[model samples]
Target: MEALEKSREHVIGLFRVVVGLLFACHGAATLFGVLGGPQGAKPDVAAWPGWWAAVVQLLGGALVLCGLATRAAALLCSGSMAYAYFVEHQPEALFPLQNGGEAAAMFCWSFLLIAALGPGRWTLPSLARLRRRPGTRPITRTSSTSSL
Candidate 1:
């Protein structure tokens, strides 16, 4: 059981890393026009939403990828993707298939899950710092506390 739990944690960590890297890749593609991106269409960087979303993608993706403030970064990324899907893609068609918003929807949900699950044990600068410190001995429940 312990080994299985450990394996699960490791897999979650791998998932986090993979997802973070891929999200960051999207940011890189859009921001720098690299990785076969920009698709011959360049969004106006000085504009309002376009540049703002790109900045969030790049910065948030990087932060999530590095496991720093993973939950917050993932949440922000998720919101950005949600906005992209609704504002840019959803109006084009009713369904994702016709609207071309599959990626956006997927990214939004993925980042939401990441935010919910947190950094999953392998993250650097773990959020554990915000929690109570570990005690030298394992905590055990006592009968006296049962009344509470």
Candidate 2:
């Protein structure tokens, strides 16, 4: 069981890193038109949506890779993809694959895992700090009443 748990951690860590980098790549491409992105796309400026996408992709992806905000990033990006697929690209399924729902389903599942599991113990939250709190209760000893 312990070994299996450790394996799961390793795999999840890799997933965060890989997915984060890829998302960041997309964000960067969309925002700055860097590395030959869409021509004259004029990335949406309202709410700096493009920039936000870039930041979220770059920073969030990094956090996921480092297991810092794996769950948070996952949940956020998952929703983004959902909106894109259903709202924006709703006319048909992904470009290929017989108009199937494969990619959308995969995205949901991946992000769900992130939200459900959160960044594992290896994250930056400092577990030691979690163990100690200001309002901890004191232990009490019971015996014959006072005067024993």
Which candidate number maximizes TM-score?
A: 1
Clashing pairs in 1: none
Tens-digit lDDT track of model 1 for 1-79: 8888768766767777888888777767877988888533656876667766777877888787778888999999999
Which pairs of residues have clashing backbones in candidate 2?
Answer: none
lDDT of 2 at 10: 61
Candidate 1 lowest-lDDT run of ten:
127-136
User: What digit string (tens of lDDT, one per residue) describes model 2 on residues 1-148?
Assistant: 8898878866765675666666666666766677667323656664454456556665666666566657777888777667655654456755525445455556556766776876654555544557668698646777866674
What does candidate 1 score in Cα RMSD to the true structure? 10.3
Off by over 4 Å in 1: 1-4, 126-148
lDDT of 1 at 53: 77
TM-score of each: 0.76, 0.61
